[model samples]
Target: MSSEVLVEKRKLKNPPLNIHTLGDRVLRQSAKRVSKVDDEIRELARQMLQTMYSADGIGLAAPQVAVGKQLIVVDTDPEEPANQPIILLNPKIRRHSDDLALGQEGCLSIPGVYLDVRRPAQIEVAYKDEQGRPQVIVATDLLARVIQHEMDHLTGVMFVDRVENSLLLNQELTKQGFSKQAVKPVEAA
Candidate 1:
């Protein structure tokens, strides 16, 4: 939770990065790990935060903005100006609690499509901060859920793909004018 990558948590009329939507090939490709957490990466994280705020989202991954890097930004309490956003470079989940929680999730990449996804109730994640210093955090509840959802983007997995109800998934996508064919489903665990 470095404040180094902090940006004014306000909606930008025009966000720095353009979010690629569903059916875009960029959203399907796995992201590469960041070799260095330099100023360039910090800038990307800042812009991503701005974009996420503009879109009224809690978290965002680099891949969502068509950047093939294992970077993610999360600010669950965006309404709180003093809350520092989490800028994770090359984030990896170190551990997850056995308890599973089913919650509704929405993605900036796939707007207007919210669906239920089951994930670990808690997670321990290891990642590099904006200054290249290593950091580890244990997140639970909404923070855990948002981090998991954004992490899925790094591996080109959308929340819609993890959704169990095919009928509702298809229906929601259709209503949003998105083709159901765009979804590449993940086999249930």
Candidate 2:
């Protein structure tokens, strides 16, 4: 994420929403475009961050909380109190580097399982900030990886579905008590 801008943390009266699991139908639904950025959207973002922190996650999407909206929250450095979590509404990757990298990825919705997935090493994204202002971020490394991962969730995709290692994926899913059928591969073998 771009270092210049800082997102602020917010307090919420409502509790965090429940995160759905891999096989849940909610996670497979493609999220709709956010029509308007309102108080509700900001509130949802706040609750999502809370849920993400509660789950020890660095990122989350609205679909993970059963909301079919194109919104995502990400914060790679949760330990840094000043490192506020980002709230992106209707996020779109404007550009991505041709260079690809294999990174270990995990999901709060698919807890207990992590997998290696190949994705662009960097990206430029355009979206609306919490206040409905236009914002763009140039992200690399973990921030880049996290943004791509959460963006997948908005499109009915999961990290395990991108795992290239079938053996490790199967073993991990089994040990994690997740059904192998839950994996819907995006790439053809």
Candidate 3:
């Protein structure tokens, strides 16, 4: 397939300033499962990448843009210049190591917030590439954390749900002038 086919071509427009935040009703809803790979989905993925890159974020999910679909785009290559994006369709974490690490993470949806979130240090993910071809990749360190973080958004989970301590959450909220409240912990399966 051509490089053009591998990258989404559509441009995502900026959302209105009134776009919903983390506690909004739209974000909490379970995303719809994607059944087909079409031009629209591909375009949406492209737009997602554009929005993410514009916000200086490494990853973005469909729900973050108010579209509840099982899709995400990630680019964790810090060395590369802007615009290298990876599209993931129906991603699944097939294997994950027991070793855990805490990483400071932020989200595009929940802006001006950062917290230490615990995640597996390594993971093997299986998903369809941009061309709808099956691809499995083993990721460690930052890449693994990025994958896990984006995948959680597909399930309506946020980084705040995985925070290692309340102190970190409080610090983030206080910095943003938001009230501090206890967030329910994400149960490990």
Candidate 4:
């Protein structure tokens, strides 16, 4: 085959997909914690952000792209340019408010599934920024929800696991005409 053909074939091989549904081992396994901010990690973050934007998603976890690392990219500004993406490495919620709010949450890993998950109205997060500098950000409302949702991926937790009502899950399945068996029970470690 010609070089051009080879390049095209490689591109076709890695075509993006809406990572809905479950059974992907990457989504189930706990991601490894990132230790250092190296060029590779930064590049990975950039690529992840590109993938998320291409997929028209608000956030993405490393595991979603089959990278078992504690890294996530989120961009919630609908009107702003996509160049500014938030990268979180070794992120941890330092504090969360007692006030809880339920919001419809979705995930790139679990496509076609959205449910009302209860989360804190506000949270203080300590994480490494894109430059690998340690930074703490106080997030509220949707931003807080995005942070909590992505952090769960690092611990092998999906939004469905936090559903407030089982009926909501069933309703989503019914709407999609997908059987309930699609969501397998997450095995205990």
Given candidate 2, what's the lDDT at residue 128? 88
For every model shown, the clashing-pair count is 0, 0, 1, 1
The number of residue pairs in model 2 that clash at the backbone is 0
> 17-135, model 4: which lDDT tens digit per residue?
33434556667788998887887887787667656766667888887777889998877863465335578898999999999998898876666778888889999999987667788
On a 0 to 1 TM-score scale, where does candidate 1 land against the true structure? 0.97
TM-score for each prediction?
Answer: 0.97, 0.91, 0.85, 0.81
Ranking by TM-score: 1, 2, 3, 4
TM-score of 2: 0.91
Q: What residue pairs are clashing in model 4?
A: 20-111
Please provide, for model 1 over 1-189, each residue's C-alpha lDDT reduced to its tens digit, 9 standing for 90 to 100: 346777998999899999999999999999999998888998999999999999999999999999999999999999999888898888899999999999999999889999998899999999988898899999999999999999999999989889999999999999999999999999642
- Could you tell me the C-alpha RMSD of candidate 1 in Å? 1.2
Which residue ranges in model 1 land beyond 4 Å of their true spot? Answer: none
Q: Candidate 3 residues 1-189, lDDT tens each? A: 443434333334553223346666566667877788888878787667767766667888888778888888888852365445678888999999998988889887778998878888999999887677788989999889888888887888878888768787878877876555524468642
The numbered model that scores best in lDDT is 1
Q: Write the per-residue lDDT of candidate 2 for residues 36-119, one digit (tens) a residue.
A: 888788878877887777677899999999999999999898767777788888999999999998889889987888888999
Report residue 19 deviation for candidate 4 (angstroms): 4.3
lDDT of 4 at 188: 21
Question: Per-residue error at 173 for model 4, in Å?
Answer: 3.1
Q: What's the lDDT for candidate 4? A: 0.73
